[model samples]
Target: MPYQKLTAKELLALGNAAPEVNDSSWCVTWDPSEEGSAAERLVLDTLPPVLDFHTSGSTGPSRCWRRTRETAWLEAGMLAEFVGAGTPHAPGAVVAFAPPLHVYGALATFLVPARLGVPVWYRKEYVGALPETGQRRALVVATPWIFSLLLRHLDWVRSFEHLTVLYSSAMLPSDAGTLLEQAGPGRVTLVELLGSTETGGIAVRRWEGGESPVWTLFPDVTRVDGDAPGDEGAVPLVIRSPRLGHRPGEPQPAEWHTGDLVEPLDDRTFRLVGRIGRLVKVNGRRVNLDETEHRLRARLHCADLALVPVSDPMIGEHVDFYVVPALDTRADELDLSPVLALLGARPRRVHVVPAISRSALGKLRPQQTP
Candidate 1:
């Protein structure tokens, strides 16, 4: 059956029932009302033993990628091995609260359980509720936004004593991790994933307990550059893995240049700095937006901050800092003196917005350069 032919309720049902289906069963869900006839025909005509997912356009335009059954199985096996090795725990039932469209959420929450033959339950709505009894060794996969929502509803979050793993991804702010660890009593293993749609899911890290951010690359993936690619201080990450899927007009490179900057700690571990495009030249000096934003965030009491570029006559572009201040805080009252002092340069402008606009997955919305 074509995916476009199904309704939203049907799609949700399919996802909910996917965990119960046997390995031989190929399950898929689509909203026919929104997709129209072409999408329906494609789903009906294609017998995809593999699963394909649309990338979250968190940073830029979204793209679709396919995950073959074999590759998916491999990914599951690798994750199980890694998780078990790092934290002595056996595989168990998984509860996914994130949308299936996101690769990290889908793979970690849904496909992993399916490949492992573990019973899984999915909640399409982010109500911050935990599953009741009868679900054993449950792994909860969600984003920081959902986590924050759950925190607000403490009664719902406290229901899960069986939670062995708490996996968060997309946009996991440092403070959020700290709060979740405190709330969970540090019993639940909090894992943050790092990877994209093109590379599938690559690595996982423990974001709480003051643990250093180190990502263990998937067994199938290998770092192409001796270190990662970028400036001497920073390295650009390149991936050579079988899990990556090809788009229609994508160049067949031996490895995919991720265009993400990183700091390589060792052969197996690295810390992601930011995207290469986030680097901007200011006064003939290169400034990494990620670093500047980090500094600004650390100094200022703001919910979120972004350093974007604005057109300049003398310089090609000048940096403008946008911030979403904490509740009851005014932009005028903000003591940006420390931030400006640290940067050694003032922003062309600082705009205080109501909320930091983000995509569905909570990633910063992509901005177009004027």
Candidate 2:
């Protein structure tokens, strides 16, 4: 049946959904959400109700994400309230620059719009002008990178009755948010999200004249100083959210040690500091690149291996491991299950090269800031 023929409740009733649905055979491509999209197709599958998704594995390997239908409704409602579209009867629309393939994109755009029973746009339509929302506000779902490109065209800012751009991935330069909110004072609302595929929607901050340093967390999410030995002011973020997403081999309602360190102001809010130690936050989990490299070195018996954290617009940071094997591993039938497990620590991409060749003077060519 076409997704438009089904209701939200009926769709969720379809249990055991697939992990990822990218087949063009599905319906709804860049069409309005009220008309439904491929999301409906995924639910129609006769599989057991296992809702699975994945992070955009741009830098590293993509990780499997497990979510439930109940959590989907909960998060969509949370996001709708965040952007001032709480009332399902209210007039509002969602415009998405990102696709449902990632967690952030799916929740903010697909699920939220479906919950609101509102018209929506996604995929290719993002390149076009804002949807005509009439008296209703339009919520835009995008990333830090897409914001830069969209800013180049402010022709549509004042076009909507009201516009709210929901951003995730990473915080941008403060001036970026300022520029957006200032486009139309109360007429425009810019909300930046501090969450991941693992933690779902943990916190949100609305940018006014400039982006604020503090973030307001969701009701179910709690932030605390990490228990690990660390400074009082700077420590890993100990997050306990009921709606937290699946982690391999971990149960729900468990505390997630967000690799991020933050100075606590209260239980629901905090000032975000950077990641802890050599660990960089990727999809809400901290990956210890240094330690991962050490393990690879020990197991592979190769001295020319290093892991570098690469920044991504979608998944924050991913690790790319550069390895100079004594012999080509692929050709030698090397068992790489151990490294595969280590790569699971974060999103990863593996590079097996001939050598870690350095300049004649031992000068590094270019280093990426983690």
Clashes of each: 3, 10
- Per-residue CA lDDT of model 2 for 119-216, tens digit only, reads 55543332444444454567777754455555665666656566777787643533365456656666666777887777788888886555365877
lDDT for every model? 0.59, 0.59
Q: Which stretches of candidate 2 lie over 4 Å from their true place?
A: 1-48, 58-60, 86-91, 125-136, 173-175, 211-213, 229-232, 247-250, 277-370
- Cα RMSD of all models vs. native, in order, equals 8.1, 12.9
Give all TM-scores, in the order shown.
Answer: 0.72, 0.61
Q: In terms of TM-score, which candidate is strongest?
A: 1
Deviation (Å) of 114 in candidate 1: 1.9
lDDT of 1 by residue, 132-182 (tens): 425334566666555565556555445555344445444455545545665
Query: Which 10 residues in a row give candidate 1 its minimum summed lDDT?
Result: 21-30
Worst 10 residues of 2 by lDDT: 18-27
